[model samples]
Structures are given as structure tokens and as C-alpha cells.
Target: MTETEVLAVAGQQAIWACLMVGGPLLGLLLAVGVVVAILQALTQVQEAALAFVPKMVVLGLALMFGGPMAMSVLRTFTEDIFAQMVSVGGLR
Candidate 1:
């Protein structure tokens, strides 16, 4: 592969790893935010904590439960990059 191809593959892997790590937490946060917004609208009592607290809780829970998966994704990405580097080095 050319230098540009190697760079492109690395970039794509980085993006994929990021999405894999963050997608679940972001999705949960979005859902919680929407629910909080609707509830606040219905009750007409807007407290910042109402929104902030749930998101914080969800974020914490997500990280706790998803930490291993996230780590795995990062580890796999790192390994892949290293393997690619080895292959590229052999080309030199």
C-alpha cells in the first residue's frame, strides 16, 4: 500500500474505534435528555439538576458497564495499527 493508503486506513480505524466506544453512551444520553425535556415541559418545573443528574447517572452507568468493551475496541485498534506499522516497515 502507498503512504496515503496507510494513512487513510489508520484514519478510518480511528474513527471506527471512536464510534464504537462512544456510540452507546451518546445514544443513552440523547434518550435521557429527550425524556427529561418532555417531563420538564409537562411539569413546567425546569431544574438544571433534573437534566444534569440523570445524564450523569447514565454516563456513569454506561462507562461502568461498557468500560471493558471500550477498552477492547481501543486495544484492537492499537494492535491493528501496530500490525500495519510492522507490515509497512517491512516495505522499507
Candidate 2:
């Protein structure tokens, strides 16, 4: 591929990798936040901790469980970049 085409492909792959790594966590947080908001609205308990605690707990749990998958995505991206570099004569 030409240099520009290669760069475009790399950028697309990078974006895809980022979404794969972050999408689940963000989606979970969105769902949790919405539920918490609805609950807070219904019960009329507007404590700052109420909103923050669940997100934090969920984020921690997600990281613990999702770290391996995130790492795998990153590793694969790094390998693809290196392989592309070799193919494009940018690496020995």
C-alpha cells in the first residue's frame, strides 16, 4: 500500500482498538449512571455519594475483569503496527 493508505489504515485500526477497549466500560457506566439517576430522582435522596459510589465500584470491577481483554487489544494493535512497518520498509 502507499504511505497515505497505510497511514489511513493504521489510524482506523487504532480507533477500532480504542473503541473495543473502552466501549464496554463506558457503556456499563452509562447504564449504571442512568439507573442511579432514576433511582435518585424517585427516592428524592440527592446525596453526592449516591451517584459516585456505584460508578466507582463498577469501574473498579470492570477494570479488574476487563484489563486482560484491553491488554490483548493493545498487544494486537502494537503487533499490527510493527508488522505494517516491516511491510512498508519502515523497519528492518
Name the top lDDT candidate: 2
Candidate whose TM-score is highest: 2
Give the alpha carbon lDDT tens digit for every residue of 1-92 in model 2.
98889899999999999999999999999999999999999999999999999999999999999999999999999999988888888644
RMSD of each: 1.6, 1.1
lDDT of each: 0.94, 0.96
For all candidates, what are the clash counts? 0, 0
Per-residue error (Å), model 2, residue 85: 1.3
lDDT (10s digit) by residue, model 1, range 18-40 = 99998988999999999999999
Clashing pairs in 2: none
Worst 10 residues of 1 by lDDT: 83-92
